[model samples]
Target: MATYAIGDLQGCYAELQSLLERICFDPTQDKLWLVGDLVNRGPGSLEVLRFVRSLGDSAITVLGNHDLHLLAVAAGLAKLHRGDTLDQLLNAPDCDELLHWLRQQRLLHAEENYVLVHAGLLPSWTVEQARGLAHEVESALRSDDYAEFFAQMYGNAPIAWSSELSGYQRLRVITNACTRMRICTPQGEMEFKFKGEVSKIPAGYLPWFEVPDRASRDATIVVGHWSALGLKVTPNLIALDTGCLWGGPMTAIRLDDRRLFQVGCNTPVAKDW
Candidate 1:
């Protein structure tokens, strides 16, 4: 059985199907590792959500920023953004069931020698710590009063991490680090403004994965959400988001062999928002 790690779907359902066909994926035997952001930005979001939800146990997805935004918007906690293409999904007959499944998804997934997250982890967070923090968010997301969690989940404050941090502050830091992070200072404080290619690397900041002495460095990290970083693979890091929603391709990597598979976007181009 093979395990494949897919990049952000971002509502590109046709591209996902095309990529799966290219891989000749056998759901009965192969497993899917999705890096989240499964909906938003492109057409076919409803279709994408329905198909991924149908995968059931064969699919594993972590929560991405956009995914969390969908949750908040659904609860009337947040408004739809200018570029959001989630209306079809919000109005789908299976909206509640699909969103329920999405909320139950984890923020981090670990197996063998790898950790899967929609974004990267704090450099201070070892794999063990990453798992625990992710569980904290998972618990909040799955709780009956998760609406309260969403209400407090939108800020970028407490950008720094601290084991001593508690309540929504702790959960928000963990959530931002795992879902919205791209760059950070050496001290593991997240930078929310920069989203261009690595050539435009911000002064005094490093890509989240490049932080020296990262505690999770021992484990290979599979990540998405930084489309500008574009299909980077190193001995320890694999970046799969290749800008599918920006007129680029959707990518998937076979975890066991490091084999790569991709399909160009079938949707119209959308410039970065």
Candidate 2:
């Protein structure tokens, strides 16, 4: 069985289908791991959500920042932004079932020596520690009091990770690192202001993957945020966003052999997201 890790799907379901066809994905024998942002921005968020949810055990998806935003908006904790395209998903007949399934998805998924997260991990967290921390957020998200966690999930405070952290502070940092982070200090302090190209990544903040001695570096990480970094494949890091929501190409890579599969995308760019 083959497993293909795909980039952010941001509502471009047609492109995803084309890419799947080009890769000759046999859902019966092959598996798919989507790096998240499964819905939003593009026109087909609803369709993408339904198709992926229908995949059952054959597909796995980590939650992206956008995915979390949709949940927050659905719970009335957050408002839709200017270019947001998630209304259809929120109004779908199966919206509750879909969102519930999405909320149960992990912030980090590790298998076959590869760790997949929607974004990047802090330099201080080992893969095991990250998984434990991810479980913390997951537990709360799946609990009866999940709305309480989403209430505090939108902030950027506690912008650094600490094993000693507790309560919402601890959960906040874990969420930020796994979903919203791009650049941060070597000490793991995040910089949320810059979302531009890597060439202009500001000062003092290095891309999370480039942080010195990142503990998770011991294992390969597959991430799908930072479209500006485009598609990067190194021995230990795979960045797969590729700006597909902005009329770029949707990307997928076969995890076993690193074979690339891509299809052109034509969705209009909607801001920096």
Candidate 3:
């Protein structure tokens, strides 16, 4: 049985299938790890969700920013933003089941040597600390108190991590770090506004992975969410969002050999949309 880590499906079910077939995926034996964004933006969010959910114990997924956005919108905590293609998911017969399943999914999943998160972790957080903080959010989402948690999930307030953070503010910071962070100030505060390539990193901000003495640097962190950052495979990091929904290739990394596999996607450009 092999293990594979796939990039953002972003509703690209066709590409997702092709990539799985290329690797000869056997749901009964192999493990499929998705870096999330399993819905939205691409052409077939519903199919993607259904397929992954059907995989049962063979699959693991972390929540990407888009995934959380779908939950927030479905829960009425946020609006359906422009260009979102999540309407079908929001209205599906299995919508409630899907949303509940997603809420129960972990923010961080780890194996012996790799930890998977939808986005990067703060350099300050050890793997155990990140998992514990993730559980705080998961507990709230999985509880009857979830609506209260969703109500306070928005905003860039408390833009940094602190052990003293409590309540919704703490949950917000954990959610942002695992799902939306890209660049951050040297002081460990997140920069939520800058969405450019690495070269254009704003003053006082550096990519989360670039910070010195990062706690997670000791083990590989499999992550997506930074499509602009593209597919980067280093000894310690695997940045696998290859912009497949934006006409790039769907990417998969073989865990046993650390080899890369990809299938080109000719998704329509925004002009054609």
Candidate 4:
């Protein structure tokens, strides 16, 4: 059974289907590792969510920022952003079921020597510690007061990790780092505003994976979120948001042998956001 780790889908259902065809994915024999953003932006948010949820145990998807935003909007804690294409999804009959499943999805997934997170882990967090921290946020997401968590989920403050952080502050930092982060200081202070190429990653910060002696550096990390960073593959890092929504190819990598399969985007959404 092969495992294929795919880039962000952001509601690109046609492209996802094409990429799956290219890989000849079989739900019974092959497992999928999806780097979230399963819904939003493109035209088929509802279709994407429904298809992924249908995969059940054959797929493991870590929550991306867009996925979280969908939940937040569903709960009335957030508004639909300008480029959001979630109306069809929110109006669907199984909206509640799909949102519930999406909410219950992990913020980080770890197995063997591979750690799958939607974005990056802080430099100070060991794989074990990161898993524990992820559980904290996951618990809130699954709890009765999850809407409250989403209400406080949006922010750029605290900017760094601390063992002393508590409440939503703690959860927010963990969520941001794992879902939205691209560049951060060596000290793990994140910068959320810069979403450009590595050459223009501001003055003091570097890509989170480039941090020296990162505690979770021992394991291979599969992440998306930073489409500008493109499909980066190294010994311990696999960054796979190939900007499919922006007309780039939807990419998938077979984890066992690092073989890649891609399909060109069929519908390119305007880069308005």
What TM-score fits each model? 0.98, 0.98, 0.97, 0.99
| C-alpha local distance difference test of each model | 0.93, 0.91, 0.90, 0.95
* Least accurate 10 contiguous residues by lDDT in model 1: 264-273
RMSD of 4: 0.6
Error of 2 at 189 (Å): 0.6
Global CA lDDT computed for model 4: 0.95
Model 4 residue 53 CA deviation in Å: 0.8
TM-score of candidate 3 versus the correct structure, residues matched by position = 0.97
Q: Give the C-alpha miss distance for residue 245 in model 2, angstroms.
A: 0.6
Q: What clash count goes with each model?
A: 0, 0, 0, 0
Off by over 4 Å in 3: 269-273
Q: Compared with the true structure, what per-residue lDDT tens digits does model 3 show for residues 46-123? A: 999889999998999998889988988988899987789999888899999989888888888988989999988999
Residue 224 lDDT in candidate 3 = 95
lDDT tens digits, residue span 102-203, model 4 = 989999999999999999999999999999999999999999999999999999988999999999999999999999999999999999999999999899
Where in model 1 is the C-alpha error above 4 Å?
none
lDDT (Cα, tens digit) per residue for candidate 2, span 1-273: 999999999999999999999999998999999998998889999999899989999999999999999999998899999889988888889999999999999999998689999999999888998899999999999999998898998788998877788999999899988999999988889988788898898888889999878898879899998988899999999999998888789999999999998899865665653
Sort by TM-score, top down from the best: 4, 1, 2, 3
Instruction: Report the number of the highest-lDDT candidate.
Output: 4
How big is the positional error of residue 98 in model 1, measured in Å on the Cα after superposition?
0.8
**What clash pairs does model 4 have?**
none
Give the higher-TM-score candidate: 1 or 4.
4
User: For candidate 2, what's the RMSD?
Assistant: 1.1
Clashing residue pairs, backbone N/CA/C < 3 A, model 3: none
